[model samples]
Target: MSYVSRNKFESARKHIQEESGNLDVLGPENRSWWRQKSKNKQFNQSNSSMTVETVKQLTKVFCDDEALINKKLPKELILRIFSYLDVVSLCRCAQVSKAWNVLALDGSNWQRIDLFDFQKDVEGPIIENISRRCGGFLRQLSLRGCQSIADGSMKTLAALCPNVEDLNLNGCKKITDSTCQALAKHCVKIQKLNLDSCAAITDLSLKALSDGCPQLTHINISWCGNVTENGVEALARGCPKLKSFISKGCRQITSKAVVCLARFCEGLEVVNLLGCNNLRDEAVQVLAEKCNKLHYLCLSGCSQLTDTSLISLAQQCPYLSTLEVAGCSQFTDAGFQALARSCRYLEKMDLDECVLITDATLIHLAMGCPRIEYLTLSHCELITDEGIRHLSMSPCAAENLTVLELDNCPLITDASLEHLTSCHNLQRVELYDCQLITRVGIRRLRSHLTNIKVHAYFAPVTPPPSAGGSRQRYCRCCIIL
Candidate 1:
């Protein structure tokens, strides 16, 4: 026996003797309870003395049994604890033990599985396993950025998970129309479907969605090259509850499709037709007259659209908050003035590359849309310091404005930076390639505007010519100038 164990046993015996005043009862039968319970099978008559080794073994056995009881958690307790963990945490918990693995992969905990965190690691086999575990019970599933998964995984989900409502398959490049067909055939309750950047999806998939998924309210088929006017028109005709439709790069869609959408989907609040060049003012006019609930609109790169569309939209869509006309070069200040006059709820406005807008547009916007929080005027060379002065003086600019982007505006000078010093809510300022703006002005602005980050792009300086006329140029410098 060790010295510590011997001393502990002797001290315990002495303390018991002093406190109880009953040394006669501390015999073999009373000292060793396990031996008494076992009918004296563990002891021998030749060695009845209480040895230190015997004390250590009995103490260890009792402690081990008590710890085992404390370590085991009740099934009800583990279930309640697992309810708070997300899908990723539950998946990680499955590695702890067989009991934990059974509870983590239970159907109740997997009703809404968001695979966004483990998208890179989740392939067909992993999805198949999830489908089998959560069959007929899963409601919402987000497989966003799961590029490694293909049609087989989706097919299994469609076959088993019938109650799926919100499914985000964003950037899943290998998915074809077959997966769409399966979803349309079974998942009738699907409300939100994101097929964004699903390159293989064609008009046939949209047709299937129209025929099967009529409950879809938010659908994003942006950059789906094969989706044309016919598919979008069919979808609008079928899905009357559609509120948000994003088809940014569908070049085949024309003004006719927009008119169909305005006529059918009257509850539409958000529409992004960026790069849909075939859409003209006539289509937008129809939308403004019909879609009264429109709140977000983006017509960037729609070169054919004129000021008439903005005027009509502002007059009709009273709840308009976010508007982007970035590549619409034809729109002048007259159209903007009309928009600013009516859309007082405008929160975010983007007028990138609109060269016609000058100080008058900014003044009108500042006076009319006081709630403007994000403003982008990149490459609008006509805007000068006078425009920024009007914006900084506006009531909302000091409290609401968070992001201000003035990239490549050559006419803007240090005076513009001085005006922005008063905008306390401004968080990000982008001043790329404005040659007139000096670093001293920007530093002064930063001192006044706390928690503000400035992003400026400076031109590269050419090194002095060598004696033989060999010109050397430094790498392009990007800093406040």
Candidate 2:
């Protein structure tokens, strides 16, 4: 009686009485219960007269009242059913009825809320309400790109949902170390954290995380300039389970922190140190030697890295599938050949602007890595049609190759297009600024491979050399170089 609300009871009774011949089917016990309800009073006294009507009423109480039966299902089962619905669907469900409203907004259903799509609509008060409603049940929450959230909202979340494990505040620039401190003091169960482009963060925030969130596994502190080697070293020492660390553009991170990470976090699989200009071959060598599980590495713009680091990776890191050494001009064919010989599982390779790689590197990759799918050789001046021909004839080109980018390889000509025709698996091809490739070549290539997307922009036509244009030609040459 107490489990079913008054409104629900009245609604069920009205429906049953209307369907079952105007309460004629209702037993005396139900009749008396209805009479008490209709009189706007509670019936504490019981009538113990055994009759057929009384038996029917008891049967109805145990088996009928469809609404009550539905509501009587286990709350845990209901919560499990609601878990598949997203936040927007849950909001729509809350408008169904009073009972549904309560069930829809239950903290258990709102545990993992992702407001990334609705970031603009989520203000501080909205976050506060959600935090209050969810309380300790909230585990994973993403407020990524929600720039409206400030320190107070984060503090409220820290106070209310301290059990939260995965929190993504990426691009929330207003948050500072204070928010991190609050989260550290309260959310001890914190695990995966993404603070990408959060400019206000510093080593203080990382220190707090080191002290509190020892359970931290994955963290992205990219573009946080104030975070130095000290913070990274602290995390390396504290969080042993840390696997993936992305700190692109964090200029303060150097060999010291990277070496510490390699020593402590041997299970690290993905490490992106893009634009960490201070990192050199020594740190990378240590990483390749210790972190055998490393699968993805991005050292783009780490200019200090020499062929020694690549050689170390070639010898040690066999599981590497994706590598980005875009601006590493110091990388040569010697290092690349070693890498191609060892890392046979290489799927994506970005050697953009590694100007020294020539036919040797391409031959090594084409013959070794048949699983190679995506390859970017932009600005590699040394690559010619011969290297491309070798790659096009390789097993990778016939079956697995999908995306091929050759943005500024000036030595490539119409002959490369002829070779690419054999690559049936080619899906997207970029040939911007290849001076000798004409529209006719691309047209022929497209006709041969109808499924492939060929992107070949013609270079600006230069007029016949005149006295006044000789300097212009020199300048154009300079630009291409």
Candidate 3:
């Protein structure tokens, strides 16, 4: 839409011709533009009557857009611009023009892609197309929840994207051990792998990855029921540089697998063993003792674990910031007291259904842990208003406290909410099933902490009166009940 002054029209045309290297298009050889006829006859009569000053108006300049762009901007700069676009936008850009298609489909523009949003649309054909286009330049790819992608498509991806380092195939149910074998053989640079909820993944898959992908640092096999201690042990023995091993709901995990991880993977930082029901106190203790640098640990649903497991973690894993021991009924106030005294940097903990914990556990946490940000004591019925009083006035409650859940703790009353009003930073509080928590108390709390969210339910104060034509119902208030 740019134009040149009539005086400089010839100069502009010459400049564009030289810069774009198409002299025959706009140079002196092209007399067609001057001889062009006006479709309206009145325009010619107006031009005859116009003065020289009027004829000095701007001249419209036209040039080949793709050629001008190719000459103006560097190819690397164009590719760099395309790199910021997501998969869908990049595909749309491919349809714009020929030059744009070449730039959008360049392998260098697609290093990392997450197709989780289009899980249903992403089938084997779509994966094959992406694999061929992004070949070798693809580094991180997540086809998580794309259940239609089977072993064949995955094999093609592995063969094409040999340098892919991080791959997430979580919830891809159609892929089996053959997909793992293909990836292990071709994509040797893979460091992080997530096979969560891929129920077909078995020992053969783990064995294949162990044999070829030695640089693996993080692996999540959560809900992979076919994976057992044998597979875990094989993976642990091969990947000595492992940092995080998340295998939640892999119930076949036993002492042998835990010991193997402790003995080989010293760099283990995050270990999420949720629902690994068979893990005993001794195995967890060994892991805690060896992997002292553990940052996040989830022992939820490990019903066999006792205070011994907590004590071992308290003594060894000082860096433990997140601990989820929900449903571990054997963990008591004594174990938590030990943990509170040692793990002062504790930020988030989920102790749901640990019914044995009493007011003393909160007292110990309030006195010891100053960095506590999130705490869930749901279904821990023994905790009372006094426990909340200690928590609300603690150092953590000053600014660090954001979320607190005391659901189903029947002993917590309005006094608990009154105490929590002092926690100005508290963002969310859950009080479901605490019958003593009245709506008046919640309103008063909101009056102080204007942004706080209190999740609770309260029944009506009284049932509605029966309707009759001869009667009128009235509610009792301050003077009557």
Candidate 4:
């Protein structure tokens, strides 16, 4: 018998013997009965041992069968598995015991290598080795947060991953239009691209991207300061199938370019223009009219947007699930009420820094958007304890709420949070910068909640200790408090 089967048999026999009682009978009839019982026990032991041995043999046979099946798996299955694994995990899999290593390093699995945060000095040699091994199979490459990657390394990647599609060079500060031009020439299959926070990228690079990749679906050029309205208009005209676009912090993009994009990209689902100070209500009105299928809209820091614009959005895009108007000082309670009434399916809503919103708006939101799972009212000066109490007391409070951010809403005190102990499903709660909440309230919450995570900023004043003689202060940003 195999080792596993032998071990199982021994264990089973030991357990059976332990459970059976040691008995002694004096009569002759009793002796015959004991002999019969001994025979039955021996028969059961033999049968069980054989069964275990058979099962062990079958398991080994099945594992071998699975290995054969893996060898014959289609290319699509390999790519799907590759997509599930990060770059580091993929590389490690390529070094896992011989057979698995070969399967992981196969050409089909090397098509998309997302080396996010690939450190320069340490990761360069590894990437070079990977490029040498599977250069021809590489297609989509993302090197986001690689501060050490320079023009030379990018050129090498472009040369190696020739059929590259969907390249994200976000935070690659050293990259310039020259690198873009090189990619345009060599990596013609590029589709989705993210140049966000690339300070050196200009309209020249965007132009190259437009000319090279005609099948682009998503693009994020946020914080790329040099991109103008002209480049944006050109992109709108070039990439018709674009579904998601984020140009937040690009000060040069104007209403004209935005209108053109809204008209051209009928399939657009998500559009973020946050921190685009130049974009006014007119631009938003145009977007609301044209992009009816918009589900996610971020107009945070668009200080110019007002209730009129939000009303237009509610009327036009009824499917909007996420709306962020942070730092838009002009938005009042009426605008939020309109949103709560219209967008009943809203999952996330951020009204941070909108000082005009009060408890009345929060009550309206609690009553209207019962499906809301995430709500943020950070720095909204007028929100008070009553508003938060209303939210915690709502019917949807106990089941769906996962994240709640009430940072900087000063009027919210311990009484408000005490009412939130019923929110059993709450996963994250941010109470940063709230001055009124004390350690006493936190202790009470901790006693009830075992799994909930609380992030609160402690107040400067020390409160009096309880009868127990000492008080425990929950520090600010203390998770799982």
TM-scores, one per candidate? 0.83, 0.81, 0.85, 0.73
- Weakest 10 consecutive residues, lDDT, candidate 1? 61-70
lDDT of 3 at 356: 99
Off by over 4 Å in 1: 1-77, 467-481
Q: Which residue pairs clash within candidate 3?
A: none
Against the true structure, candidate 1 has what lDDT? 0.86
- Of 2 and 4, the candidate ahead on lDDT is 2
Question: Best by TM-score, which number?
Answer: 3
Q: Which clashing pairs does model 2 show? A: none
lDDT of each: 0.86, 0.88, 0.87, 0.77
Candidate 2: list runs displaced more than 4 Å.
1-78, 459-481
Candidate 3 whole-model C-alpha lDDT, 0 to 1? 0.87
Residue-wise C-alpha lDDT for candidate 3, range 10-89, written one tens digit per residue: 56556766875563443332345433422334325432333342233212123233443555678788789899999999
Error of 2 at 426 (Å): 1.1
- Write the residue-wise lDDT of candidate 2 on 111-171 in tens digits: 8999999876679999999999999999999999999899999999999999999999998
TM-score of 2: 0.81
Better model by TM-score: candidate 2 vs candidate 3: 3
